[model samples]
Target: MIISFVQTKGGTGKSTLALSTAFSNHMNSAFGSVALVELDPQGTLRNWWNERTELGRDTGRVSFHHISSSQKEVFADGIKAIATHNDLIVMDIPGESTGKLHTRFACAVSDLVIIPMRTSTNDEAAFADNLYPIIKEILKVDPGKKGCFYVLPSFTHPKANRDTIMGYFTDILPPHVGCLRTIYPDRSVYENFNREGATLADYAYSVRENKRHSKQALSAAGDVEEIARAITQMLEKEHVSAKKEEATLRG
Candidate 1:
């Protein structure tokens, strides 16, 4: 399965979602191997992988590859190559400056394209104006592409703002665009884990830090696990649906 993490605006935690999804898959052993393709110009995913290596963490289940925006063909080839060896391939896409061709290409090959958005007026407007159009165009080109598109509400606060954003999405997205039930709240522990070059689970038994870090690590793990469960259910439903469709056609 090829999953692309994308959004129209920056600071929406797209790369973080990509990393968390990859980590979750690795922990569950749901995939034989997972490859994280960093298509973002900032190379945030690549940097995160390097940091994990520097920290001497277990990076065996996930491999990170950097792909330049100029190399569209190479990107396509890389996706195909990774799919051969890995059961899951997660692509981190640039948020602000993605061109038409690049967006279409990623959407074309992805089994799922996830757009992470924060609860904000600007984010809602951008999603409606920029991201929705691109998604529509991609579907137009390949209507039968067996891919699921989702708009994940990220960095959600337990406030009215979150509800407002949820209402907006419910109004706009079609029935096929799955709504991710897991809302990732904004927390400092996530940033700390990113800087430490490890996931929340990795720091659970750390000897260096005190009790606070360990507690925070456990909390973050809980949140990530919830999101991961939602994602897994979505993918499993797709798989089951596809098999049923095949059987129906055969009958």
Candidate 2:
């Protein structure tokens, strides 16, 4: 499974989500092993992986690569090679539309493309103004794509009007565009833990040592696990369905 997490606007937690999913799968052996690709010029994910490695964390099962290229052909070739060698590749690209054809190529090869946005007014407005057209372009450029796009609501708060916001988003979302059932809440633990170059799954501290943090820590960990599991299962279903379609067509 090749997965790409993208958003046109910055600060939508796209990098964090990509890293979390990759680490969660790596630590859990979620997809046997995983490759983490950093295509973003910002190199945020690369820095985090380096810090984590320097902290003596084991990244044996996780392969990390930072490819700094904007040329469409180079990026397309890079993605093709990565997809060939790795069963799963999670790519974090630049959070802007001008990153060029690499973004569209990534979407073309991906098993799933996650477009995360916060529930804030700015994010909503940006998603409305920019995202759909980008998706439209991807379909035009990569017309043979077998993958689909999903809108992920990130950094949602309980105090906000989530239902109303989601309903509006759903109403406007075009066909084949879906929403993720799991919403990533704006939690301090997610920020604080990752700031120290540790994933929630690999936090190293005992889940039971701190009584006050026990439930919250475990719940946060569960959120990552749920996402990893959901993504893996979705890929499996697609593979199975694809194989069946191939068999029917051959018959």
Candidate 3:
């Protein structure tokens, strides 16, 4: 399965969420091999991946790929090559500054396109003015992509009600766009977790001696694990539905 974390507006936690999800235990166990692909030319993840390498950290089942090309053909060919060897591909797309080129391509190719948005006026407006149009265009071309686009509520208050946040997105989401049942809560841990190219798990381990910091780190990790589980479940269900449709057609 191929999943892309895409948002037209920057500072929406796209890169962080994409990396954390790829590193999550659920995703690692669900797929044999996973590829973390960065479509951003700015190289936010490229720098981080380099740090991981320099530090000699183990990547385990995840491999990193950076494709800075804006050409659709190049993107297609490169991702296809990566997909051939990997069970799952998690992509981090660039923001609106790229002319929405990467945004449109990622939405078109990904099995699931996750848009991380905070519950705020600016985010809602950005989606309406920028991202949703591309989503609409894709759905116009292929109606089967309906459930492929999901809105992940990001930077939500840690103590906020999940149902309330989910309902907010549900009420405002355009046709064919669905909302994830989980939220990426705002926590101090997220801001500091990636120091020295550390993963959330690594951060948690390092802060184990400090009770407050350790608790925050664990909670943030739990949030990522839940999101990963939700994504895998969605893909598995889609696979079953596709098989059923195929059998029905044959019958």
| Residue range 49-73, candidate 3, lDDT tens digits | 9999899988999999999886899
Residue-level lDDT for 21 in candidate 3: 94
Point to the candidate with the largest TM-score: 3
Error of 1 at 44 (Å): 1.3
TM-score preference between candidates 1 and 2, better one: 1
Pairwise lDDT winner, candidates 1 and 3: 3
Clashes of 1: 0
Extract clashing residue pairs from model 2. Answer: none
Q: What is the C-alpha lDDT of each candidate?
A: 0.74, 0.72, 0.91
Ranking by lDDT: 3, 1, 2
When summed lDDT is taken over every stretch of 10 residues in candidate 3, the lowest stretch is 233-242
Off by over 4 Å in 3: 248-251
TM-score of 3: 0.97
lDDT by residue for model 2 (1-251), tens: 78888787877777877888887843347566678998887788889989988988777567888888767677777767877777789888676655545566667668788887765678767766766677777778765344468777777773456576578668766766777666677776676667657776666364567766666666677777766676676677667877887799899
Please, what is the TM-score per model?
0.86, 0.84, 0.97
